[model samples]
Target: VPPGEFIPVAERFGIASRLDRWIIRTALSRHGAALRSGALTLGFNLSAQTLSDPQLWDFVDNVIEETGAPHSGIGFEITETAAVTNFDAAEQFVRKARERRCRVSLDDFGAGMSSFEYLRRFPVDTIKIDGSFIEHITQSRFDREIVLAITSIARSLGCDVVGEKIEQQDTLAMLSDMGVAFGQGFLLHRPEPLERIV
Candidate 1:
């Protein structure tokens, strides 16, 4: 990951999706092997370009079938900008995923096009509030207002809201007060190799 040079290398080989599949397969396999242990879910970030394909749904179904992973065990994270830009195409993907009980998150939510219109059109199970807003909540009334508003709105829609990049104790307390259902950040656990997940 030096200089982040390998990111494009992954995309160039069309291996992003392949890598995602591997992670899903491995996570699910591990979870099953440790049935006596608790359940585990895997999160995968898909490139916006990948959503352009109508067959993406079928490919996901195949992966679930091959890995014996429940649709609920998989989480697909989509950027708000990409989703709003290609709402039509993304809608179909989201709907099909939901129909199959898969979880969908509006990644980096509240960062771009905070349009109520987009929220109405998007079918998602979770909203990952942008860390920028979370980080500044103690210092900015505007940030607190936005966080409060988003939490209220998302909860009313039956969607869970997660505060990201919550590094401070007060931030976690405030987010809990605002009724955020989940959190993810270094304050919690940094992403590690998949082998150690289970």
Candidate 2:
């Protein structure tokens, strides 16, 4: 199942934590060796349920040690909605992860209600601009403005900004002009298996 569908179902059944563990374990088992060799960086999305569970951190720490994956090569992506749901816990997660040399990013940044507020609370390494805004960024002045504003704020806070759903060259060029640090979508590269890339 897609994460969007599975996450809600798992949360409703109070099994999100178990699902999270499986996801983390599977990801590590598949790519941990390559990650340790510095072949590529891996990013994992943690559900809000898992983020709020204090015990999750200990589990993650154990997995990292067991896999010998470099902390610096791992990135945890906390959605804007998730970060806002439990600000304190999310802050703790980000801080602890940073302490372990792991990167923390605020995913789907503009999709949430309080995007800017979360930025002030969480010291994330990157902000992924929501694709809704990027889809028509070139044609719509409002979308362009939103992207500009997000990029500007992120830059001032020393956070790298990434534009999502970049399927057009014009959009890519616009994002580059706006100083977006990264772009993700079909125009650049399609998503491929980690093993294939490694």
Candidate 3:
């Protein structure tokens, strides 16, 4: 899992730019080794602060070179709020990442009212349907509709959709019925040490 506290530290220290580089370098070092062993690609969560940095591209270039990891082997996950707040810069970053063959995903989709608009603006390759909606799929028709809407939009945009926080077998079956392309949750796989995963 991505370190949850790193972004807060970067913001508090006013060195978010440097922290972004450090994240890329540190994450790639471990993830690159995994790639070499033919493991699944690693995903990194991008902080909103990092998304706005003009120098982020430079950092990305340096890390990619240092790690010798294919752009396709790296996926960046940015929250919906972050993407909308930094829409223009995020769009450019997404475009550039795509050019480098890196995949971009809109994380926490459907958290706010403007998610669809954000999706229209950014060319993301994946949309991770927020857990709030996924968790209550059976309890509320509205939640199911929201997920369905996201699924339809993703399909139309030619993007894969991943459902998160799937805790029950029935929930997994519901999501499968909706034809979600991927999913992640304890029910599917829990986090284990790297050595244990293999």
Candidate 4:
């Protein structure tokens, strides 16, 4: 199932942090070799519930020490919605993660009304433009304008912009023109099993 369907339930049940821990441990253990060798840099999506957990970092440290994954190869992604929901905890988590040299990305950025305000507070390494906006960017002048504004502001903040859900050549061309350094979608490659990816 897509995480969107289940993550909220997990959060409401207060099991999201445990689930996040398991995901981090499993990904690191399974991909430890590639991560330690600097051949792969994996980003894990963190839930708001997980971010607020005080022991989250301790759990992360133990797992990373166990797996021997370099801090540089470990990354975390917090959704704009989640970040806005718990701003204080999110800010704290980002700061601590950054101190450990782990990259943090604000995913689905611009999907929230207070994105700019939160962006000013969260020291994210990247801002992933929401897929909703990218879906019809080529056909919507409004979408284009939003993307341009987000890209420009992200540039000023020295944060990378990653376009998501790109499905057509036109979308890729447009993103490239706008200087989006990275993007992820079916146009690039479809999702596959971790075994295949590794």
Locate the minimum summed-lDDT window of 10 residues in model 4. 79-88
Which residue pairs in candidate 1 collide? none
- TM-scores of the models, in the order given: 0.85, 0.93, 0.88, 0.95
Compared with the true structure, what per-residue lDDT tens digits does model 3 show for residues 121-166? 7788999999999998988999999899989989999999999998
Better of 1 and 2 by TM-score: 2
Could you give the candidate ranking by TM-score, starting with the highest? 4, 2, 3, 1
- Give the winner by lDDT: 3 or 4: 4
Q: Report the Cα lDDT for residue 41, model 2.
A: 87
Whichever of 1 and 2 has more lDDT, that candidate is 2
Which run of 10 residues does model 3 get worst, by summed lDDT?
A: 1-10
Report residue 184 deviation for candidate 1 (angstroms): 0.8
lDDT of 1 at 42: 66
> Roughly what TM-score does model 3 have, to 2 decimal places?
0.88
Clashes of each: 0, 0, 0, 0
Regions of model 2 farther than 4 Å from truth: none
Candidate 4 wrongly placed segments (more than 4 Å): none
Which residue runs of candidate 1 sit more than 4 Å off their true CA positions?
2-38
Instruction: Identify the runs in model 3 with alpha carbons over 4 angstroms from their true place.
Output: 1-17, 36-38
Model 4 C-alpha lDDT per residue in residues 16-53, reported as the tens digit of each score: 98899999999999998999888899999998888888
Mind giving the per-residue lDDT tens digits that candidate 2 earns over 122-171?
88899999999998988999999999999999988999989999999999
